[model samples]
Target: MEDVVLIYHNELGLAFRWKNTVPNADYERIQVVFRNMSFYLLQEEISKFSQNIRSAQFYNCSDCKANKSCRNILLKTPLEKMDISLNMQELSKLSDLVEGTLFKLDLQDYIWGAGRN
Candidate 1:
């Protein structure tokens, strides 16, 4: 299974998505990886100079039956939009992670198992 999936929005930028390849992996470890990825993207690719990302979204697209929670992945970007679908608790946790002000936000789950926010 792929560890990460990336989607680019033309010149506006790209987004980093985490794929739940290790279903049984420790959540803390997963969170650390997520943080590392976010930092890399923000510092290396999604910064103000390079491909300025427009939005960031987190969700699983694997065939794993086990439900995974991605609420611990904190995103740091100067993005204008963000789309995330997580449970109320997770959503609350996400709100604390966003460092930049967002102009557009989509918290509703368009995919199943992506808990409501």
Candidate 2:
């Protein structure tokens, strides 16, 4: 991750961004690349995605013989442009990653007054 600054991360995935080489570079967006997919999103978009993940529901299939960790839940992105298949465990971990990143971002804004600009 030499090209990006890591915001937050866990066993499931991580959120990062390109290193700010310019003094006046924007910090309003971040890259969330993991789970074999990549997304460049704003803070609001990340928040929305976290909310949607928290609200999603999952159910086990009685007929399916696959393991419980099998990917069954289909989660749509905030803009409804992509669908991510995840198992219950994956969903939980992803939720943690997104929400944790958001928390860190918010804490930075609050402590450093980053939101003022």
Candidate 3:
């Protein structure tokens, strides 16, 4: 399954839509390949697939360094739209994250007056 995905990306550059018709195990393997790929390669793949990634969504992904790191990485990309649905504490850091990127951001699921910001 992983080989199939890698070959597809190498040949088609994400131009074709991928159907999630496989089992969770296959998905997990494919995810590992994605994780190991460089940010430049990933960006190229995304651009080749969609021309541009205009939007992104994050949900319940706090409390994990890897997840937060992924979010931070996305902020550095040429993204025009984003939605971050983490806790209030994390929201305070959004300004730093979304800096330099002109994006339409949506903050959600954060508690009011949660001693953040």
Candidate 4:
């Protein structure tokens, strides 16, 4: 958290960016650092990821031999090579995090009249 400007966060994960970094070209991007993985995604990509997570299904793994609970959900990201696995509670938190981030971004846009630009 010290190295990045936190956009939104919860116990599950966060979206952030390195301090003082400027947009390379046009669109701005943020780093979604969650659990053991991280991704640099645009605002549209984040919205798509949030939609995918919301529409995902949860199930119990009948053949799971692991001692931990077998109930989990797998969500595909906007990226082709990455996916996320989460239990019910974790899924909820992640949803909150992403949705909150989107809300914050929208608010910032409104306050700054970004849409009129």
Better of 1 and 2 by TM-score: 2
Q: Candidate 4: where are CA atoms >4 Å away?
A: 1-3, 21-27, 57-71, 114-117
TM-score of each: 0.22, 0.81, 0.17, 0.75
- By lDDT rank, best first, the candidates go 2, 4, 1, 3
Which model is ahead, 1 or 3, in terms of lDDT?
1
How high is the CA lDDT of each candidate model?
A: 0.33, 0.82, 0.29, 0.77
> Which candidate's lDDT is highest?
2
lDDT tens per residue, model 4, 1-117: 465677888897888766754545233778877778888889999999889878873455546776443336778898988777777667777789889888988887887896666
What is the per-residue lDDT of model 3 for residues 1-117, given as tens digits with 9 covering 90 to 100? 333333122211221212366444333221212222222233233343222222333334565656454444233232334322333333333332222111111111123334356
Looking at candidate 4, the ten consecutive residues that score lowest on lDDT are: 18-27
Each model's number of backbone clashes? Answer: 0, 0, 0, 0
Give the RMSD in angstroms, all C-alphas superposed, for model 1. 18.6
Task: After the best TM-score superposition of candidate 2, give how far the Cα of residue 87 lies from its true spot, in angstroms.
Answer: 0.4
Residue 16, candidate 2: alpha-carbon lDDT: 84
| Candidate 4 vs. true structure, TM-score | 0.75
User: Candidate 1 on 65-93: residue-level lDDT in tens?
Assistant: 44555343343443346432343344333
